[model samples]
Target: MSAMLEVVGLDTCYGRTQVLWDIGFSVAEGRTVALIGSNGAGKTTVLNTICGILRPRKGQVIFEGKPITDIPAHHLVGMGLVQVPEGRELFSRMTVMENLELAAYARRDGAVDKDIRGVLERFPVLGKRRLQISGTLSGGEQQMLAIARGLIARPRLLLLDEPSWGLAPMVIDAVFDTIKAIQAEGTTILLVEQNATQALAVADEAYVLEHGRIVLGGTAESVAMNDEVTRVYLGGFNPRGQ
Candidate 1:
């Protein structure tokens, strides 16, 4: 499979303070890749840089084999690269349907309404609450809505930042289930999650980021079995059930 998204020698910063250093990885077409690390490990920064929310001081971001390192966030959205941020940044004042509609603002295709219906069917809870205010939904519902919104954009590579954050265990399971369903439908994903166990469970490839650099990269199974990853991220939980 070809690389759908590639980050080469990335260095990102907040003003004078650098947060990511020489970061590199690739998400292959139709595959899910996970980036796992502790808080402040610069995982989200990687996503932001790829989605064009932040300009990298050095390095290149290639999407579908094209250079998009300096592209603006909105333009990247139209080019089929979209990020579902960590915080579930919904339009708090808007209804579920309204928020979903706004996600397609960059899309010129006339299938917005059709896509909306499709996402609603995929997430039936959101379908029942279409008219309800997004802010009023439960934490899990909000996360679902966020993912659903990203899907509305028809992204070729989806950047998901902490999809399981702040949700109950069952809710986290549900979210992962949705992620698997989405991947099965052929949307390539680059997942950034502190929840290493779940992330490794669904990902084909895994990269471990530590203190702003990639400390390990390999198949998910190998990463899960590494001593440091098992101790620090997975809490000794064996993903392969050995």
Candidate 2:
């Protein structure tokens, strides 16, 4: 499969403090790629740069065979490169329906309402609370809404950052299940996650990031078997039990 998104030789900084160093990876069309790392490992920085929230000081972001390193965030959304950022970034006062509608702002199609209904139906909890303020929802519900909002944008490549952050284990399971369902529907995904076990389980390919650089890259099965990954990320629980 051809790459849907590529980050080649990426370098990003917040002022003079560089957060990413020659970071590179690619998400293939119709595949789920996981970028797993500890917090402060520049995982979110990578997503921000790809989605145009942060400008890379060097390197290129290629999407759909075009260089989009200079495109603004809003324009990228219209181009079908969407990010469900960390912290769920929902409009605090907006109703669930309102948040979903606002996500389709860049879209010029009449199907926004229809898409909203479809998304709400997929996330039935959100459907039941369609009129509720987003901030009032629980953490898992807010995460669902955040992803639902991203889906309403009709993304070709979805950059998911920490989808399971701060949720119960059961909720995390549900969230990963949702990720699998999204991939099964043929949407390409680039997942940046701290939950290595879950991320690798759901990903077809995986890269391990340490201190802002990619330290490992392979099929998710291989990454899961790495000693360091098992010790640090998987809590010494080897999936292979070797």
Highest lDDT: give the candidate number. 1
**Stretches of model 1 off by over 4 angstroms after superposition:** none
Query: How much does candidate 2 score in TM-score?
Result: 0.97
Q: Against the true structure, whose TM-score is highest? A: 1
lDDT of 1 at 173: 99
Q: What lDDT score is found at residue 58 in candidate 2?
A: 98
RMSD of 1: 0.8
TM-score of each: 0.98, 0.97
* Candidate 2 ranges with C-alpha deviation above 4 Å: 240-242
Candidates' RMSD to native: 0.8, 1.1
Per-candidate clash tally? 0, 0
